[model samples]
Target: MEKEFNQFIEKITLTTKQKDEAKTKYTGVCKKVHDYYYDCNYDGSTKFLFGSYKLKTNIRPITKDQDVDVLIKLPQETFEKFNNYQSNGQSALLEEVKSILKEKYTTTDKIKSWGKVILLQFEDSTHNIELLPAFEQDDNSFKIPNTENGGSWEVFNPRAQIDAFNESNKNSDGLTRKICKMVKKWRNFTTSVSIKSCSIQDWAIDFLASNKVDQLEIEEILQKYFEFIRSKCSSDNKSYVETVLKRIEKAINYIDDGEENEASQEFRKIFGNEFPLVEDSSKTNSFDNNIFSTPRPWLEN
Candidate 1:
């Protein structure tokens, strides 16, 4: 069982590395666009890479193929055309870049096909890229104002959140206490738990930055989550246990949504006969059992 868990941890960790590499590829692309935008316009500028990669490595290892995010201010837009909450200038700009690169870029023998992606090589050697354009805010962050559908690219810098995540990781000597906080942050980054494809740092940032999980709650959740992480480490069930913990997190959420029986059912799936209960348990030892084994009465009851 220990061996299996260890394998799980290793496997998940590997998945994170792969995802990180993909995001890095895109980061490279963003760097090129930022430079190209400036060189063509003869204006000085910088495009910021904002995503999981900015956080501490251990805090947000990539789990899937989520794109690396980039934010910047376009140089040519008129004041009437762009502001913090609005901008449609980028799509036209992207096409111009594509055309210019296609005409001027020289492809090497290894290159079967090439375009603007070639220019992005300036950012990183490994190439995974996604293009998002935004206007700058007074806060040194970019804003993508929302449309009626709430699908606006609108976002703010995760700098403060990243600081919080770094502090937690540093204080704990590399352990992270922002489990829920991390998940909350990632969700804002257009990631979902079912995908497990985002950098952990992104999630931690969202958690730290959003009002969803405050500091005290973050600490409290981590205290329990740590036990789960350690229990997996001790039992040698690291990966599957991690999976199970994820299930437990979801189950608790179900309970929060008024789905108590559904939550218990979810917990039972992971725990089998060792399933625990809180209805008749001692108060002093409330946090002791495996989170999955027992119905967290504070929640379930």
Candidate 2:
């Protein structure tokens, strides 16, 4: 896998075409919001990219639900005004955002209210844009409406998260970003692992932020990531962690033996078909012809 890390990175990186499509869709989201708010006699606010896209650590999803998160910050005064007008203030605010998106994207996309965000899913595209309509607070935090729990507001600082990751990336010689992308790639392949995408990002950021990143390589950082989860995970997730950790160890051994083809195959066991396989002259005679063997335990969909 070490020999083919660059290939794996290229495979997982979003292409220019994909990025442009996402940008166009996101522009539509912003435009719809602006149009809605303009009709209401209020100025539409600025939107900030958050989550993996903001950090530039996103990998291509293996599944249909590829998510890109952005935050739309309206004025705090508007939030206060709206809250006073509704019995269920937060729910009303969230629904208002969802309603605008639903109406605007009716022909091309499907909009769903999920947690604090409105999800815009296009009919012919795998990319899912999550719009978190927020109120910009004086403290530089965002007040997001949660329709659940009786329409309460929650404060989130995505800027802080972005800053932390950027700072850590600088010190780690960019290993922090590489590790995050690699783990995301691993998670994309692990079907039975029920961890949320946000959880994965948070866990990776927190782990890498505090780690000693002096001389660690990619696989070593990955091993430590699994070990960190093994230490912190509940009994249910512990089993999955154990399985992944063993496979990682095997891949590392293959790397140590200078068997990168085998190493890539082992890494593929953990990260699925996205891990590329390259022919090696040393293994030309030892290669197996049977390609119909059962998939590795962790590689099953």
Candidate 3:
């Protein structure tokens, strides 16, 4: 079963075309976020970047353009001052971003402002840019309120996650980019149900939690991940994401560990054999069907 899982993981990795596509999107995300950072005065000077975008790929992976997450840092002082803050930092930064986006992306359609924090999404023109404003805590760390997984909310220690990610990356050149490709690769394979594939982190979290896989597996996966990138990705094109997916598919075929099987089954059951939040009629049973699946009047038609 472990071997099967390994095979699946290996198979799900990205391919040259997918890697190139992911890289193109990756570059766009980096540029737009960087521009937003500078535009918002959140550059190195203030409202600093403190997400996967900056760190080496393993710690903070980016799969798609939308996945290149950017969090606007609010120092302890600023975060405390905000009237109300949500665990998702970007929501907090919406309004401030609105004005800047309006000025920069003038031609963009109506950019709505609403939420625990505002959400700014710029699409229809070039690559998309989603800005999330987050407030830093007194200790320079923040946690999301509710997460399904026990570790539902991810912890960010501004300095630590970045430092830890970077320190390890030094051992591997272009580590940040490598993680991004590996993640994109893995995700592209796991959720073959449709184009709205689940993020690699989403799958990984489910797989790891359900199987009770240890950090060693994560690191082992990471090392193998490094080799995959070097062997497959190219200068003109990056097939990393697609190749990784093939590996993941291979892993999925042999994945029969009790916990993993449970998790994967649970994942398919809850996420409709794919990621949730889509309109695919065939794949819309978000709740677990086996666990007293919710009835849909529309489905009766």
Better of 2 and 3 by TM-score: 2
In model 3, what lDDT does residue 269 have?
32
Candidate 3 lDDT over residue span 1-301, tens digit each: 3343333334443445544643454344334444754545322333344444344232212222333344544444443433344354334445555676566445554455544222334453322334445555667675322222321224555577566455544543333344444454444444542222223323333333234223444334543543444433444233444444444444344343323443344323321333222233323344345456666688796
Tens digits of per-residue lDDT for model 1, 176-268: 533533332323333223323233444333433433233333223533543333342333334544665577577767656755556555644
- Candidate 2: count of backbone clashes, pairs at least 3 residues apart or interchain: 0
Model 2: lowest-lDDT 10 consecutive positions: 36-45
Candidate 2 has a TM-score of 0.85
Off by over 4 Å in 3: 1-43, 56-67, 73-93, 96-100, 107-119, 124-127, 136-138, 142-158, 170-180, 189-301
* Shift in Å, residue 86, candidate 3: 16
**Model 2, range 1-301, lDDT digits (tens) per residue?**
4457767877888888878877777777877786665555323347678887778777785346667788876766768876786466876777788887877677667777867888887887666788988877788888888778667778999888888778877877776677777777776677666766666667776787677755766777789888987777667677888998998888789878877777778888887788888677475644553344546788767
Clashes of each: 18, 0, 41
- Pairing residues by index, what is the TM-score of model 1? 0.42
Clashing residue pairs, backbone N/CA/C < 3 A, model 2? none
Per-model lDDT: 0.43, 0.75, 0.41
Better of 2 and 3 by lDDT: 2
Which scores better on TM-score, 1 or 2?
A: 2
